[model samples]
Target: MQTNSSAKKSKHILGLVIVDGVGYRNFLLSDFVNQSLNTFDEVVIFSGLPSESFEMQERANVSIVELPVFQESGKTWFWRKAKEVAHMQLHKYNFAGIDYNLQKNYPITKTKRALITKMIFRITSVFHSEKWINRFYRNQVSSFKKDEVTKVYSELLKREELDLLFFTHQRPPYLAPLDYAAKKLGIKTCSFLFSWDNLPSKGRMAAPFDSFLVWSDLMKKELHFFYPETKKQPVEVVGTPQFEPYVLDRYTSSKEDFYHKFELDPDLKTICYSCGDASTSKNDPFYIEVIAKLMEQNKLIEKVNFLVRTSPAEDGSRFKEVNKRFSFIKWNYPKWELTRKDHPEPWSQRVPLPEDLKDLRSFLKYCNLNINMCSTMSLDFMLFDKPVINPTFGTGENDLYDDQKYLRYSHYERVLESGAVAIVKNEEELVREINFSLKNPEARLKEQKELLELQIGKPLKGTSQRIAENLNEFSKA
Candidate 1:
């Protein structure tokens, strides 16, 4: 509750965060913003959309600025378009830097065009050193993009002198231009290692950052491995703020109330099946059906009830047919309401009005066994010391789905290495794993404990505090 008079004495710090999706809610729920309020005299947040969870307008010291997502223009737009052509050409040479999903999903005509363009680049690369050309092209494109970014946002940035420029996520296109603006004004910049898979699996970052804050030592290692150039810069391990609420009692619900809300039989063993997004795990409905069939046949453990929690990005309408077939299974759909159905791609501006933390806490608390197809929820369940089952089975002809291949992705590699979960490959394995988890709930107790420690690190408390302190210390320097 900062006052006008008191706010006048505070230093101004600019903060950038994307409240576009539920995945980013941790930045709002955690101590990052709260600590900014305490440490800085005045704080300005440039966000895609306002968050209901964080009522910044009510605070006297905080202000919200609606910034546009990035678009290429001026000299940069020309170079950007050219680079796209060159990149397509380089791909034909099997240079190995292209985004595979993009190529895989492209229309047949587009793929052919890309292939022809790649052949052209391959021929040119042979005569003119492919590695050097690629490096030179990257550096040039990056430089022009930065220049154009500064040109576009210079006026907005000149409004005030900021003590620190902090961007919460690295993948957003808007960050590079914003970072360019910060550099033009000589403002110190910082960014968070936003996701678990960002380093290993995700494509190139928007831009190089002055300071990098990561979730764990594992993430620090990943930053070095992927972008060794950043090794010279400061890489701070602040842990992740998403799990901070779990350490607090205020967010947890009473066991009796939690059971009653979802209409569960307290005597029955409750199993949770968390679904992934539609694009990747299109067969989630099929998997849910399998569980329903097992339950109906009484093949599973006696009196074992199943609950399905759909992905936050989806409306859960895809499961309507399955739900009608299996009226016995319970569900908890995301409560987010979208204002504009056509807000734009990436839908980063989608507003999430949810009791998400409380609900997730309850889910992990009451569910005896949790199941999903390689979801981060496994980590959440592990934090609660609950067992998890990852069913790698697919639906449809030939059992094809991108999610089947996701099990082999680098992001899930560490979790798999930890061996805390039961990776079931087929229907029989899925049933066996579920029954085993129900019968021997503590089958992987030692493994689960070790996995939690390795992934999340110990002394889970004070993650937000540490982040705040680090920001404050940097501001002073």
Candidate 2:
């Protein structure tokens, strides 16, 4: 428990980190904690809530502090409205940074009218210019004034000389004040790009960072393409720490035990249907139905057994209607239990439990093919050299089924472009892809290789170690 003697050559190089919620603890922190502990002389975790997942070693070098979860406070709401006015002005200038691809892609009269409306925003925005807005906010509000929530961050820094401030997730507005305080104090700051879809789908970062850690070159490019201002910031490709276990040997589970646990037939080729989030893809049961229908018709049903693995954020209530009819289909709900309050919070819901780690490894190992509507599990399954099938078709319902919507998602553009997986349009194509993948498992090997190199990046093993090494080098510098 004694502190490392070599850690104190100068003022302690403390790495102050912000862990957003329960989900980050399991999915992110667990993978990177040991490395952080070893790389920094001292590590202090500023967390939104208290959880067993954040509990680290009893070593004297590590400390944990709980803080209120960042919510949209009055000050933030005012800032957001002010920024909206600024955004209106920028859009009038035909801002290249705005995510207008969706409008550009779908060219209809309505969109044209919308574009014209955005032009009108310029008139309203003229009264509240960007320069005026900045000056007003700066003169009226302080980043760490008594009424500001960021005052606590100033107090925390006053107690210790922090060398570095790192945020695991960069989009939380709550951290904006802290980042501002850090900048005023001249502390170096960095953040990890949370996910593949983050840059395109998510909002602007809470604050500009000194550096950023990305999963691959794809993400770094996304930062440049979307937020051109970030092009000058240092971006280190650390790969993704979540997939580290996929590359490790210790987390592997025996196939016999895994199949038995799931009550799956070991002889039959297993196909895992990883569900998407409820808000986006509530009709997951429809996909489940398509699989069930194919199984009933005995097309590839005899050869493949389909398993349903709901999203960690889903409670399986949406699947109840389909679940009752297709009682024969096997189900695998996420083992990570959530409280009533935790269920609604995305970050809290994403926190993986110990069992999830084992379950994921086993599912990937036993399943010969993976099926999902653009789940990150595709990357995980690819790591196991398994074929991935993305079902883009829908059941016969206008509101219920729309295949075109999934295609427009910006993140999947790269995956589809790379041809990493088979995109099945209907049941016929689904069966065809499944049979082909099972018959010729190595057919997509070339595509997977391309994805690994361009999309995921190489040296898949030891990502956590690489991240630690980079952090240590930064500290030394």
Best candidate (score: lDDT): 1
For each candidate in the order shown, give its overall lDDT on alpha carbons. Answer: 0.69, 0.67
- lDDT at 10, model 2: 49
Residue runs of model 1 more than 4 Å from their true location after superposition: 1-14, 50-57, 73-107, 111-152, 395-397
In candidate 2 the C-alpha lDDT for residue 254 amounts to: 87
Per-residue alpha-carbon lDDT of candidate 2 for residues 190-305, written as tens digits (9 for 90 to 100)? 78787776666543466667888888888888777755667777778888776677656656788888888888877888888889878666667888898888788788835667
lDDT, candidate 1, 126-168, per-residue tens: 4333343345345545655445445656555556457777777
Candidate 2 Cα misplacement greater than 4 A, ranges: 1-30, 56-60, 81-148, 339-350, 394-397, 401-403
Clashes of 2: 1
Weakest ten-residue segment in model 1 by summed lDDT: 89-98
Clashing pairs for predicted structure model 2, backbone only: 23-351
Give Cα distance to truth, residue 212, candidate 2, Å: 0.8
Best prediction by TM-score? 1
Error of 1 at 176 (Å): 1.2
